[model samples]
Target chain A: TQLLEQSPQFLSIQEGENLTVYCNSSSVFSSLQWYRQEPGEGPVLLVTVVTGGEVKKLKRLTFQFGDARKDSSLHITAAQPGDTGLYLCAGVATGNQFYFGTGTSLTVIP
Target chain B: DARVTQTPRHKVTEMGQEVTMRCQPILGHNTVFWYRQTMMQGLELLAYFRNRAPLDDSGMPKDRFSAEMPDATLATLKIQPSEPRDSAVYFCASGLVRGVGTDTQYFGPGTRLTVL
Candidate 1:
């Protein structure tokens, strides 16, 4: 079973569009991380949210942790072609287990 | 840049052959994790180590898969008699564990394995 499920598994948008991806889970987590991966490379960490209701902004991207620590969200404003990649959300559950969410693959058309 | 490094970026072998993947975690990091990625399963955690000791490996198939940390810097995952279904991209990540857990993980360029 997937602990974390992301909505809209695949997304395609034109440049300058805005988008939001959601990561939901039934279990609570101590911390959550967001990563962006390009082709032929590993996922690169974007941001980490530790506290409930925490929000972090990285460049044109924004990451938010749920109030209950069971979900997270990633938002991009004025998307660019460089934002096209696989976005993954990972949570640190109890016992230090790292659970990755069903990734959201985004494609931006120039 | 001190990042995780993995060797044999691509490997192709026949079924029933043994496959070994190696990883070198970033220096001074005490935690190591192994993951496999595929279209069907996404990214699945296989095993993890802390301070050169295995902390958890329940996600790994014990029959044909084994993971070991020979030293603090080197971690290896081996598959004996690998099957066709074992073809996937294997990733290794390392992090520094604080009191709670590691939230930031630095991943390496995965090793793509194909078993025909």
Candidate 2:
């Protein structure tokens, strides 16, 4: 079984702060995806990184895939109240199976 | 925007009861998945189907848990003799690809089940 371990299970920070969440695993993945889920709703896809050492940016969010494809990170800059949500990282292996991360709940207060 | 739809947003039932959750995938999606979420376990994939065929169900308990896709648009997850530990949010997601590679999944609101 493959497992993705996420760091900083809970995070609280004031507005304008910068934060980075990490997800690591021992197994290799064909693709990695980042999602943000608000309360009372299912997760929404933020980005998908398929290549090693890949970097993608969406406004204030920057996502990176590890050089070895065993890790990924999501960095948020100038966090605001709108950035608060549960962030999840999922890895897709050779099979159709997806392994989800431990999840990181972020709260940005104004 | 097309999205996955799940029925029975919330359900409360006693132990040993039979519980069923249904999902309607997006119009063109061919893959459907069921996941259980809890504080301790995070999100676990119970089962997934592709083109109305079972792909993998290793994460599901064979005795009490059953997942099936009756058609390309409908998928169901059933639990017989449900236990207290089954109280969690069950999510149904669908995607456009068969599996693997870069298929993006769209998730439904999820059905929250409480077994007492």
Candidate 2: give the clashing pairs: none
DockQ, cand. 2: 0.89
- Among all windows of 10 consecutive residues in model 2 chain A, the one with the lowest summed lDDT is A91-100
Residue-level lDDT of model 2, residues A5-101, one tens digit each, is: 9999999999999999999999899999999999989999999999999999999999999999999999999999999999999998875668999
Q: Model 2 chain B — which ten-residue stretch has the worst lDDT?
A: B96-105
- Tell me how far the alpha carbon of residue B23 in candidate 1 is from the true structure, in angstroms, after superposition: 0.3
DockQ class, candidate 2: high
- What lDDT would candidate 2 get against the real structure? 0.93
Per-residue CA lDDT of candidate 1, range A1-110, in tens?
Answer: 68999988999999999999999999899999999999878899898899999999988999999999999999999999999999999998876789999999999999
How high is the lDDT of residue B74 in model 1?
93
**Candidate 1 stretches greater than 4 Å from native:** none
Tens digits of lDDT, candidate 2, B1-116: 78899999999999999999999999988889999999999999999888888899999999999998878889999999899999999999998885446898899999999999
Q: Pick the candidate with the highest lDDT.
A: 2
Model 1, position B1, has a per-residue lDDT of: 82
In model 1, what lDDT does residue A64 have?
96
